[model samples]
Target: MLIDSHTNLHGETYAEDLDAVIERAREANVSGMIAICCRLSDFEEVSAIAERYDNIWCTIGAHPHHAKDRPDITPDELVEIARHPKVIGIGETGLDFHYGYSPREEQFRSLRAHVEAARRIDLPLILHTRDADDEMADFLESEMEQGAFRALLHCYTGGSALAKRAAKLGAYFAASGIITFKKAEDVRQVFRNDIPEDRIIIETDCPYLAPVPHRGRRNEPSYLPDVLTGVCETLGWTPDEGEAKTTEAFFRLFSKAERPS
Candidate 1:
């Protein structure tokens, strides 16, 4: 079965007919999804969606944009939210210099909180690193010196140095629809050989990075095969083999997600 490891199914874009969207994904062969929480207010909505769909799981933590608002958002609070049976991971958190919606210092503080929470609870972290890869790598290296944590750089768009650094830290890398774009050949080449096969992940980052065939349209979990198609092409493998291998890689990272009964 195929898994869309990252998505924001609770966002307003799906407000009118989330069921239809999910049903479409199922018909497209997507067996599961991890609905992500982007803010304090999104936790309940994310959790509710996870509860409603047996195949969908959820993650807890604030995004970089909301970091300043959640300064008081403690590791204890994150761990508490993660105690929910359906909550399988600890973030969508990390540095985002592109928008700087929250101050950089606060973003660092927030990222540390997520790392601490993941370490404390023995859960995986979902990272979101953008233009601040150098800063992120520096912080992550320092943090790794103190202690280790399980984490994945979700929708990774970082340069080779950052990717190599994360791999050295025993962290996983999640690729999104950007890898399928014409100009992202550089990104594809950077990650193709550097990352270990088992630590690589594929995500739609949906409602956002829709892969080719539907490149300009709104994205959804159903389009994962499109991203996988690109990955297979780059890696010189068949789509079925790539799906099986990446799905295997996904499970290895999120071992907390037992196959649904």
Candidate 2:
């Protein structure tokens, strides 16, 4: 079985036929998925989807882009929300200085808030970082000095230094459809030899980063095989071996998820 580690299955893109989409994912051998929450409004919706789908899980927290709006959010509040049995991770949150949608300072604050919440609740932090590797790495280093927290670099597209730093910090690395792109061969090679299969995960990051052959279209969990295929091709492994390896790795990292409980 395969797992799409980070997906936005509750978004409007699936509003028309979410059931069919999930069914398609199952048909494609996707055993489980994590419906990520990018905004506070999405927490309930993401949790609802996980509850409805037997193999689905959810995470609760804000994205960096929405950090300014959730300025008053507290780590305790996030822990309270994550007490839900279906919630397994603390965030899809971190710095996104590439867009500057929210000021850099607010992004850092939001990142630390989510990190603190994860430490408080004992769940992994699913990070979304883009074009802020230097600062993100710095913050991660400083935060580690205070205390350690479980985390995964979701849809990782950063430079070698950031990837190596994350690995050194014991954080998992989730590769998305971006790894399959022709332009991302360099990115693929950077992680190909360095990242252990046990510390790697495959994600579609649905409604974004659709793999080749469907690159320009809206992505979904059902198309995760393309991402898996890229991972296998780059690593010189068979699809079945890749599936088993990644599925094992995924369940290990997101151990909070059980058989529909």
Candidate 1's residue-wise lDDT over 1-261, tens digit each? 778999988877999988889999999889988999989778999999999998799999899999988798889999998999998999889899998899998998998999999999988989898799899889889998888898799987788899888889999988889888999988788668777777777899889989988988989998998888888887887878888888888888787888755
What's each prediction's clash count? Answer: 0, 0
Q: CA RMSD for every model?
A: 1.0, 1.4
Which regions of candidate 1 are displaced past 4 Å? none
Encode model 2's per-residue lDDT on 1-261: one tens digit a residue: 888889888767899999999999999988889999999878888999989989889999999999998988889899999999989999989999778899988888888889999998889999988888888888888898899998898988888888788788888988889888998987788778667667888999998989998989999999999998888888888998888888887878888987333
lDDT of 1 at 9: 86
Candidate 2 residue-wise lDDT at 121 = 85
Q: State the lDDT at 145 in candidate 2.
A: 85
- Global CA lDDT computed for model 2: 0.87
The TM-score measured for candidate 1 stands at: 0.97
